[model samples]
Target: VNILTTLILVWYSPDAKADAPQWTFLLCALGLFAYQSLDAIDGKQARRTNSSTPLGELFDHGCDSISTVFVAISACIAVQLGYNPSWMFFQCFCATTLFYCAHWQTYVSGTLRFGKVDVTEAQFTIIFIHVISGIFGPSIWSTKITSLDVLPLRFATVAMTIVCGSVSLFSIFSVVFTGGVGKNGSTVAGTSVLSPVIPLSFVIIPACIICLKSVQNVYENHPVLYIMAFGLATAKVANRLVVAHMTKNEMEYFDSVLVGPVMLFLNQYFNFYIDEYYVLCLCTLWVIFDLMRYSAIVCMEICDYLSIDLFHIPLVDHPITQLNKNGTTINSSVVNTGSRQTRSRRHHH
Candidate 1:
């Protein structure tokens, strides 16, 4: 639903404000609200259906890592931020960075912490922005505040974003640097606490270089496609990080998803023998395919190993049996009993 809503914005309001139908903004507002509600309840539904597993958690986060891009783009379009592509770029990437850092912090601390003002609050704020745009048209964000006289609403929004992002980053960094849960203050994966930074930089540095070096104004002309492609690449990296954290494995510095950004970067380096726009379209397609393929294969492997279904709960409840470190068969019924007891205690509270 969220992807379909973003596609609508891309079709009718590619430039966000120019020639956009008024109703599209309202639809965006509705679609995003629905997405948020569904996302919130996904875990509950899994548990209710007796389908919760580590794969469910990974799949949920994996979808969220990608949805971050769609939601950010939809909000940008709602506020008509495409007029200033640089600001649009900052806002979109800032969102992805915050999300990535949250998981990075998790990789170090062995816990996912939420600040007082977090994702749910941010989603509501964006929903409100969409509602305002839907009612007043996207021009309202360009109007100066009656009291301030100099501050455009959109710049004010950007300022708020920067401030909130800064505080969030500060909090994440504090946890990441101080909360290692492995030997000699390393990460949960038993690697140096800072090793994850290399993988993150690999994702961000190439993105910055490619967007800045687009001689054909590819990013300027196709900000949505450019950002979507970049978002998918980042999402793939985020997914790998999540998998590494779950499996207690080391993350690779290079990823297949980087191919998309590298394609555009190398084309520009050689003076764009193929038009940058065509390359961008192809890059976007490749990133989408690569992310989807990687996600499918990983999920299937996890399901096969765990002896679980991806989307359905078996009608007959039975314990999953697995070999332990001692090579003894262990029944998962004990784990399920503990989970149910935890749920029961929470319900009482």
Candidate 2:
């Protein structure tokens, strides 16, 4: 359903009509409405039907990841920022990263937390913003509403950067706070320290590289190519998170996931032509990876459901169970208890 909506947005995206014609905006409005309404109830429906398998979870998240980029893409058109490359990159980069952070929060803390300004709320707000833009036309985003910035593109770009940065910062700090301070006020050491930094590094390393490259080339002027590059990189990171969730493993996937295609997107400001084939190639590779991973997950889930234990893939297990359920998975007491039990069992034998 969300895919259909995305296709519809792509269909109407090139409407060269003056002010985008209210009718085109209406189509986008209707599509977003249908998607959000149905998407909201999909999980509950799955749970009701007792079909909430791991495959369903994977399907659900994958759809969300795709729709997130599409929705932001549509939003860009709605607000008349479609012609700009910086806004495009900002939308895709922020949306995909924040979605991953939500999952990261779950993996480490075992808590399914939705932030105060999380995705659900953001989508709902965008829906209304689309409606307003549809009614008022794109001029509303540009009219002087404040002294800070009058243009929606300018305002949105800055506001979005701050919000995305804030959310990323909070998620990073959440990791450190998870184990950084002990009851006795001592600092967490070794693996505990690395765990917090691992997730942070995933976003930080990519952001650092992308921003530096953006600065050197002034990528803001070439939003089309900038978004394509950033989107591909973000997709790779999101894929790693999905694989991590499926396998129940904690793997380091930072910039190490950057393959050949993403590298070509990195250099230069003087050259201005975007290779459509280049973008399509990267996108196709992404699709193939998504399909294979998704198929493996579906097969794994079906076999698990049927109680047929066969080949084991480490990607689907919960990584934090190594810690106790009460959140002491890393406590010294638990470690010592297991050590003592091992010696006692040997003695009894």
lDDT, candidates in the order shown = 0.84, 0.53
TM-score of each: 0.88, 0.64
lDDT of 2: 0.53
**Per-residue lDDT of candidate 2, residues 1-349 (tens digit):** 5446544545655421125555556666777778878788878765544445566566667667666766766666666565445555566666666766666555554444665666666777677767877788765766544655535443564476567568765965576356533333222222233343364455446544544554334344334334444454455556556655556565464444354234434422334245434543454466446545655665676677766433322222122223444544441211222112111111110
Clash count for each candidate, listed in order shown: 0, 12
lDDT against true structure, model 1:
0.84
Runs of candidate 1 with Cα error greater than 4 angstroms are 147-150, 317-349
lDDT of 1 by residue, 86-158 (tens): 9999999999989989999999999989999889888889889888888888888988888888867888778
- Model 2, residue 311: what's the lDDT? 38
lDDT of 2 at 51: 48
